[model samples]
Target: MGPAAAAAAAARPQKASAAGGVPARWVCALCASCFVFGVFVINRIWSVPEPVKLNEKALFVERTQTRLSEVYIPCQRKQNSIHIGEILNHVSQTHDVIMTLDKTISNLEMRLAAARAARATKQEKSLISADSDIELSKVRPKVFFVMGIITAFSSRKRRDSIRETWMPHGENLRRLEKEKGIVVRFVIGHSGTRGSLLDHTVDAEDEQYSDFLRLDHVEGYHELSSKTLIYFSTAVAIWDADFYIKVDDDVHVNIGVLGSTLARHRSKPRIYTGCMKSGPVLAKQGVKYHEPEYWKFGEEGNKYFRHATGQLYAISKELATYLSVNRRLLGFMVHRSQCGAHR
Candidate 1:
């Protein structure tokens, strides 16, 4: 081969090698640039500043604590509110129970007070009745005036009140009977239920006091007129008196005034003396002064004939004897007659 051919070949190989090396260097430079960009991106992502990282951690902790506090505070407030509501409800219920108990206690106290008052009243009545009986035993058999106070089994308190106020008791009663020739007695009758507790109590009282004039008729509020008739008949049979007085147990009588008034009428033989009243005869039932057989009184609201008042009245011995003798016949007419005691 020629020198020129050999040189051309060497030049061609060298040009090829040089071209390949340039391409290799360009590839390595491109790979190095890509690696540097990846390293920069990793550093930017992982390698944060110390102060910035601490600030982020602190922010995260503060946000978590704030959230927890908000939740806990709301829950605690709700629990507190519920507890307060329950306490208020319990207090209200307790207050209502206390009020009810107080009312019950007040009622019991009132009842106890009433019972004590009643017991005291009964004891006072028993004492007065006992005193009256002692006085009655000293009275003489012969009396100028026989004052019969109408009474019943349940009228011990009324009798005691009269004895304490106007009627005399013990030594006073005995002195009055001895000085004035006037005898006072409580008039009563046996109970309808014979030998019952009521009758036994009355018997005990009578045995203790001996101031009661027991009647044959049964005791009843509806038979006042009949009781009055029986009283006159019985009084006449027992005592010899110038005047026989029928008085209600509830009446407050001035003994001095009564004695003086009776003395003025002592001369009259067939006298029936009392406070004269002309009240109307009540025919209606359930009335205060009701008359059962009011048809004979002329009309429903007709005024009765002027007569002695039934609460207190006096009859002469002759009239009392007449009433005693014809008591059975007078009993029928006593209620029908309008002239109350005079009839």
Candidate 2:
């Protein structure tokens, strides 16, 4: 309308500029505020102590229909921040968000909770009351399978021979997937591309079964820390799949034994099974591959590493929850035994 008012209007962002139902003005304000507040919030967030929840013990039921372990959380962490606003967060590391919907929605929440309670009751009825002598296959749930794999690659994250980084491991993984039924998958590092990584030769960690896969290393983007990529990738498995496993290409997996072992387990422990070692959590932090305050060393007791073991252990769905919940504290331990200098 007026010249002064028109100029002011022109400075404002368009309505379409807003994304995720937020407007351009809000987006601009949020961005500006975050730039100002990032250090402060990051400091506060980093200062927050992470949890120390142990894994929930897994029990299996034998039945034709399967006592499926399906846990659907009705109250998901809300993506929106406060009462009226939200940020576009693609968190590789997710912090559980809480949403308090309106009165009507709150009622729905109660209903859902009630339903979950009823389901728990049904489960209680289905479980053993006092019978230790009973074999469960009759009333037990059917077997359910979840499949995933893990391997390290060169900077390319593609399979190829490098000076000595991950080529052999990559080849072994391909063979494991092709020859054995053990599943394998790729990981792209998060902080930067793997290709840019300097060619550093690391000794072959497992020399037992080296001929299995055609291992050429491809670098995936992600920082290498003791538990960094493993924690993040395992956290993803928390969202999908019933069972998960991570393996290095040099490892030999006896698929037949693996399948039988899983099939027979009445209760599966959250374990770092292949090779177990323990130590305190490290306090050191990385700059480009930064470690958060939460990644501090653990209590005085020994802690074990599941990494050095040849990459062929099985985990049930429930274990995924623990990894997600404890990521901040357990995400960055590097296995130095695998590290070596370029030849």
RMSD per candidate (Å) reads 24.8, 40.7
Query: How do all models score by TM-score?
Result: 0.52, 0.32
The top-ranked prediction according to TM-score is 1
Q: What would the per-residue lDDT of candidate 2 be over residues 266-317, giving only the tens digit for each residue?
A: 2433433345443343434553322233233344333433343434455553
Looking at candidate 2, the ten consecutive residues that score lowest on lDDT are 51-60
Residue 85 lDDT in candidate 2: 42
lDDT of 1 at 227: 81
On a 0 to 1 TM-score scale, where does candidate 2 land against the true structure? Answer: 0.32
Off by over 4 Å in 2: 1-149, 152-183, 190-222, 225-240, 266-272, 279-310, 329-331, 334-343
Best by lDDT: 1
lDDT (0 to 1) per candidate? 0.74, 0.39
Q: Tens-digit lDDT track for model 1 on 8-54? A: 98899888887777577879999999999999999988777867989
